[model samples]
Target: MQGEWTGELVGPDVWVSCRELIPAGSVFAFLAEHRAALSPAETFADMYPSRNGRPSMPPQVMAAAVIL
Candidate 1:
């Protein structure tokens, strides 16, 4: 599988870029901020899958991000 990616700050000058395989230490903020860069299906499945995969975010956290 192939996809687009963009890097963002995890700390001062430290960056994390999500791609076909996300780096293990990437934070939720990085994933959510760059959500649009990935395929819709991949984003949904990875970020909010119906069953086992990566853990889904709480509704409150998702809502907070959407509001920003």
Candidate 2:
């Protein structure tokens, strides 16, 4: 069943952030900077179910995965 996006952890807190690894001028960095501004998650929020048995992947995460 479709569910709300809750998000998942890929690694520990000590792990280096993606922003640190990606160069500032790179496309990834640009996307990262504009990710929230663009509000992909909020834009697509209504596409997913709000209530269900299990939480779904975050809309922003899914959008990033598709873009990357």
Candidate 3:
């Protein structure tokens, strides 16, 4: 199953914001700014055919991590 990135970007536990630290135009900054639009999890839906297992980490997030 294709999982979604539903975690709050701004939450009570989040003391420091990523947008405040990631350097502009850097690869990390680019991924933080455009991860969802560039790598929608829906595109990898076919990779997980069964719907009875544990929820997978979002593909977009995985892709972003790989890039970083």
Among these predictions, the greatest lDDT belongs to 3
The stretch of ten residues in a row with the least summed lDDT in candidate 2 is 10-19
Candidate 3 local lDDT, 1-68, one digit each (tens): 66777875534422134566667888777666777688787788898888987888888778876866
* Ranking of models by TM-score: 3, 2, 1
lDDT of 1 by residue, 12-44 (tens): 532234343545556655655554553243444
Sorted by lDDT, highest first, which candidate order results?
3, 2, 1
lDDT of 3 at 23: 74
lDDT of 3: 0.71
Error of 1 at 10 (Å): 15
Tens-digit lDDT string for candidate 2 (6-60)? 4456664222355577777888777767765665566775776456556676667
On TM-score, the leading prediction is 3
The better candidate by lDDT, 1 or 3, is 3
Which model, 1 or 3, shows the larger TM-score?
3
